[model samples]
Target: MNGPRHRIFSPITRAGRASGQRGAAVFVVMLVVTLLTGLGIFAVRSASLSTMASGFNRQLTQTHYVADYAVLAMVGELGLNAQVHSTNMTSGGSTQCVGFAELVAADKTPSCAQYGYGELNALAQTYSSQELLQPPTGTYPATVVPGSLGASPLEGDMRIEVTDWHPAWPILPGNDATKGQLGYAMVTVSAIGLVRPNPTGMAAGTWDTASATAAGVESSRAHVVLGPILMSN
Candidate 1:
């Protein structure tokens, strides 16, 4: 019995060690799978957010262009000495024409197209400036243009107004009647321009409505000087 019995290896101990090792390996694999899943979800969410931001930016730019065009068109109509009827005038004085006209002696009236330019009104003279800034109330009914706004499926409608108007030069010389006949007077006017989104891509006035423009609407208020048009007798 003597010479120290050599320690014998226990199968149970060896089996326990192997089982613990297998448990650790399984836990590591599960952790790796969970991490991969988390990464995939994060990537997908980032992509979705990016797409949404891109879309919004595109829409904003479109609105800006539409508004700019509205301003240009309005200028073309008023700045180039376009003929206007008194009944057709919407904003200015009800009886003064925009173009040059002689003051008729019989009627004691300036011989204008129809009426004088509407008084130079303040900003947002036509629509509520507050409501024009946000969604829901910001959008307005599409105005009919004589022709297309340009391009297909992308054309939009517009809203424009004259925010300020007045004579820019050649002031009447202390009511001098003689000067009126010999001298000429110039006039300048201000205007505002806006545009709305048309999802249906239909022609102006055909599908444009207040309710339809309640969303995705954009507005622009511009103080544009039409010019010193020659008004003379």
Candidate 2:
């Protein structure tokens, strides 16, 4: 009987081994690609949210400024009144005015000739003169009239109110009435402002009319109230 013959097996070939390794490498590359894609998507979402928050904050800030400006304008008008002693007017006795047209007209200046500030001021002056001359019959002894302050875009709506007028607390003795004592007046004004989106894709949403309509980007009602004695004594 012949001795058991041993068949010699060749060692694994380098080319074959390399081919198998290549397959595994491809799988690893695919997995990395998938992970990177997922991260990219998450980054995009986070950025979008941040942008939206920033836009909303800006809008709110603008609204507050608009309201404040309106109240200040009304205060200026009240201050211009010669008959009312700046210091001694009672809160409840102060007047209130509302009207979008009137407000827009009054806001105009010579530099804003196209906006018609002159006409608006004339109208307001006339109205104020009349109101002061006639005075009110009520016990509170104040008038609430409607007048325009300046010219605003047709889309803008504005309203103003003066209130909280009262004789100064801790009235000083020996104060002359002719000069008028210090008095307080409160003013509230509301306005809406529109914002347009960036055209170059720096911000979300487009500047088109459709985007504006969808976002409801119009300004909200702005209100400001002045407290304490405003009129002079």
Candidate 3:
């Protein structure tokens, strides 16, 4: 009478199937959310690194420009080279009062042995950094030279050194020293950007007033740059 005992599924079974489907959908959504979160984190980190790099590059360029100015200033000073002191009949055996510019007019190049140049002595020569400190007193008079930059907030310190001078090399066609036209000289210019104040430079006697610079952000890093200068007409 039950027509071969045909079975019908109950609501509970249907309910079980629906729950399973919901669980799978939830798992897929959670996986997609996790992936999106990971991608977002990577993007943020990349942007942060790029910003830091940009700041570092900006600082570096600023310091470089300041160094370039130092070299250019030295060039101008050399352009106005002239006898500033008369090296008395000193140990070098010289008695003349000619400026560096005037030396270009001489038959031979002047002596700059003490400054790691040539050995031969001469009457007139460019002054060194230490020599520039004091006035012209003894035989070795202080010739005019490029000095340290005054106080500045942007840059820490700037200096230029006129290493040596010589007649234009190879004696270009019609190159005349007597006409105040000669080859170029080398100048070493440096610019320092300070991340931390110098204890010695600030206070000579103190030892532990401030800590040394520690590595952090490249944009906040200290820099020391030395640039060579070749000055001519």
- State which candidate has the highest lDDT: 1
Models 1 onward score TM values of 0.49, 0.39, 0.43
RMSD of each: 12.8, 16.6, 15.2
Instruction: Give the residue spans of candidate 1 off by over 4 A.
Output: 1-9, 81-155, 169-218, 221-233
Q: Best candidate, TM-score-wise?
A: 1
- Per-residue lDDT tens digits for candidate 2, residues 1-233, read 89999976556676778889999999999999999999999999999999988866755554455445444544555556523422323322322233334544776211100111233245456767432112213222144332221121112122343333334334345544443534333333333333333223222222356445523233233222233233544
lDDT of 1: 0.44
Better of 1 and 2 by lDDT: 1
| Cα lDDT listed for each candidate | 0.44, 0.41, 0.38
lDDT of 2: 0.41
Give the per-residue Cα lDDT of candidate 1 at 158.
51
Task: For residue 35, give model 1's deviation from the true position in Å.
Answer: 1.3
Residues 1-233, model 3: lDDT tens digits: 54677678899999999999999999999999999999999999999999989855655564555455444444444345422211211113221222334674665444321211111011123443232111212222243332232221121323333323333344445545443432333322222222223323442123343333321111121112111222233
Which residue ranges in model 2 land beyond 4 Å of their true spot? 1-26, 82-158, 172-174, 177-233
Model 3 TM-score (2 dp): 0.43
Clashes of each: 12, 40, 2
